[model samples]
Target: MKNRSLRIFLKIALSTMLLTCIRPAPAPLPVILNSPVGETITAADITFSWQAQQPAAGYIIQVASDSNFRKIVVEETVSTASANLHLKTDGRYWWRVRARNESNIWGFWSEAAFFILQRFRVVGALKTQGYPHDLAILGNRLFIADGQAGLAIYDISIPEQPRLQGKYLDSLNVAWGVKARDSLVFLAYGYKELVIINAVRPESLKITGVLEYPQPGYGYALALRDSWVYIAAGAQFIAVDISQPAYPNLRFQYYYPRNCRGIAIENAYACVACEQLGIAVWKLDTFPPRQTETFDTDGNARGVDCRDGFITVADGRNGVIFLQQDQAGHLTELAALELNGYASAVTIEDTLVFVACGSGGVAVVNCADRANPFLIATITSPYAYKVGAIPGTDYFFVLDRDLGIVTVKKEF
Candidate 1:
């Protein structure tokens, strides 16, 4: 009877011990931290707080350099609701909390939380559709010339988030280039000539003037300066006097050896990039205009821009050619960098040059030294046709034949 009673007592004791072991220990204190935060937190030193599973004797907080809290940087025992932490540098930090009993047994670590510190500037990108050819910014608005679909206006007051204001679809041919001054918006439509519209009210853009080209297959490019408007027609460059915005008159036409694809004017000289003749510098100061000098290239030059004392040209076959401009306004070939594919357009700002290639994507070149240009980075789209850069923005706008318009932020 005594043995039986002893065996029963042993079984009951074992069962009670087994049940006590199976019951989960009180959960450790939980620490919740905020997230989706900035890299650099400039607020007053952060205060970390936590809630215990129950009224405890005290709490232990361990801040570690790693997510696992293996390398503890700070271990503190506090009996308050908050702990003051002063972080000096920027990096990812891990933290956890623990509760202790009067018997000096420490509880398990709570869930880990992390935070990061950053210092670099953040850049963003935006995308659009329909051949976005040229971008013209006026005040807080950005105007895009959408080929075939007409003109599209976007409110770029907020550079990061551009909103479409309105779109006008009144033309058949594609709108190639757009230039805005005051309340006037000049759109270059292939074969349709120049369409002038009043853009004061972007929501209600109305055609105010239409200047027709004398011949077909003309009016591919347009540039405006003061009261003069320069148009690049096939094999010829036409100048129009826009002193009277409502009535535009053909000032004159300068015949070149090959088709004029692009034109840019500075001072008294007009630089024209010709497909067959290379680049022709005309003396615009002359009454009828005379070709003063010409710089020949290996391939057809499609785009041209002048900055400081150097002229940059984009050849369809030869990547980019740097030409030095003399005091006489003459161009001398300095250096040429060969690109992967057919180069169509080029824009130079600060220390970077953006090249738009047909199927080769966009090539970014570091042109700090005009004598020795170096290719820095190349970002390609499926079929990038053209590229444009805003003067003061690091944002690059690309026109893709298949993807319409894609905006990329320059990380470098």
Candidate 2:
């Protein structure tokens, strides 16, 4: 009787072990949302959201350039069901997610969700608390007059990954524009003054000099040539000689009736974007501006750039006006490129004019046929203020008020 009872106990123990070992793990299937399988994301940045899974300790998401996910670009394990990703390429991307249980065993991946991202694909972006109005780059360093957040600097050695190197905060006034040369950074601090920052070392900035305006307005735009800094201070065009960077000396000021927002200097002449007055040409080589010419715009003249003997003006709703300035200090309208969006900032490359169109992103205008300039491509963005091209590359830098600095490849 004892032997039979022992055998029976052994049999029961084996049966219990078999049952436990054969038990299958419960895997949860998470449904996809937002990034529908067949949808396309035009922007470079994408947000992936999904339905929550039950009995999950964490989640695993993979984003690959290929549908098979053979080469993964984004593989993350998180406790949340959402992921925001920034990609460098403009093409089809496959994404999928899986859940993990307390035992550390991962469930099968959910159905792959494939999507497309094209057009003005953002490859690099720097998001900050400050409002980025305008940006200037010298070598690998990027300087900006970041509105209320003050003057900011970043390392653009890797344009796709702009790392913040330093920042100087000014609470009393707003930083409207910035220009950097050698080791000096000239910042436009409203009409209060022009603040000169010694940025030989981006981490440690020094206020080497300040040039206050005679009147109360503020400094808006600046252009530097040789050692002279031509700036737009409210309704006046002023020049400061920075031969001694530590002590900038005011040279002269030319009062104009319109508000000056942007300034561009080429050779001995400087073009000022006198709002409502359109483009104001000044002979900087002579004192008191010598001679001046103004072009008519349908609306506000917010920005200006001089390139290849052409003066491109971002004339708000008036579109973009191309003016040809002669040695006589006179400007004649060459062409006008208009878009549905408001032109806020303008830059030129070859025959292409890149205009920052507020919420409409960047509008590329073809001026090859100067007499009939027209928009060729549009890069969409939620908030865009300024668009500038990298000196040696085909990439464009966009300063977005809310999204910070965005780097886009000018493929179109």
Best by lDDT: 2
The prediction achieving the highest TM-score against the true structure is 2
For model 2, residues 148-234, the per-residue Cα lDDT tens digits are 888999888888888999988778888888899888889988855589998987788889999875565578879899988888877
After superposition, the stretches of candidate 1 with alpha carbons farther than 4 Å from their true spots are 1-129
Question: Which run of 10 residues does model 2 get worst, by summed lDDT?
Answer: 27-36
Candidate 1 lDDT for residue 236: 72
Q: What is the lDDT of residue 218 in candidate 2?
A: 76
Worst 10 residues of 1 by lDDT: 35-44
Instruction: For residues 235-315, write the lDDT of model 1, one tens digit per residue.
Output: 678787888877778778777765787777777777788899888887777667777889888998988877776888889
Q: Tell me the TM-score of model 2.
A: 0.70
Residue 61, candidate 2: alpha-carbon lDDT: 87
lDDT of each: 0.73, 0.81
